[model samples]
Target: MSWKKTSITIVMGNDKYPKGTRTATFNNIVPDPTEKQIKSFAEGLQLLSDGDTYLGSEVIKHDQLSAE
Candidate 1:
């Protein structure tokens, strides 16, 4: 398997969590994340998790050659 670089955004929500810290993974990737990506590409990543719910996901960074 090859390595793919992507800036995914994961927004979590629950009654116990507040709006300030609701966002699990903001915009940008782990290496160097900028602000937040309001328009996510994917969601529902934490269906198996507990109270943490996946609001959305966005792949800002990716390899164009991976398509081939």
Candidate 2:
């Protein structure tokens, strides 16, 4: 079976303004992900998937944030 892995970001939003709620974002890598990276990511998700889904994060430099 072939599965595609994806990356997503979870963000906390302001509760005071119900309409101002912020949603998590998902950013897809460009130039195509390597086969090794794809396999590893899929495996990680599978290991964590026990009837439920989970999200992971890796901190990057503030300047590295993409405006796109």
Candidate 3:
């Protein structure tokens, strides 16, 4: 068998989380995330996680926030 390599990166925010804090939104017991919502959330997370000491912003699609 041939050897393979993979890389994974994890970044943490500065906020202090409780010891037992865990994500429950993705447990499937609640409503699934829409494609637009997922994309928006991912972009927001990436912006916050980026270590660069510069301010960055982007406009999200209005429909993503609307309940329609």
Top candidate when judged by TM-score against the true structure: 1
The candidates, ranked best first by TM-score, are 1, 2, 3
Residue 15 Cα positional deviation in candidate 3, in Å, after optimal superposition: 23
Query: Could you tell which candidate, 2 or 3, scores higher by TM-score?
Result: 2
Please give the distance, in angstroms, between residue 11's alpha carbon in candidate 1 and its true position after superposition.
Answer: 0.8
- Evaluated against the true structure, the overall lDDT of model 1 is 0.50
A best-first ranking of the candidates according to their lDDT comes to: 1, 2, 3
Please give, for residues 1-68, the per-residue lDDT of candidate 3 as tens digits. 22232222222333344542222122222133454655555466658653322122223221223345
**Per-residue lDDT for 23 in model 2?**
38
Which consecutive 10 residues in model 1 have the weakest lDDT in total?
36-45
lDDT of each: 0.50, 0.42, 0.35
Q: Can you write out model 1's per-residue Cα lDDT over 1-68, one digit (the tens) per residue?
A: 34356555566666676563365444435543444433322233444556565555444665455556
lDDT (C-alpha) at residue 56 in model 1: 51
TM-scores, all models, native as reference: 0.40, 0.32, 0.30
Q: What is the Cα-based TM-score of model 1?
A: 0.40
Candidate 3: residue 47 lDDT (0-100): 80
Model 3 RMSD, rounded to 1 decimal: 16.4
Q: What's the lDDT for residue 42 in model 3?
A: 46
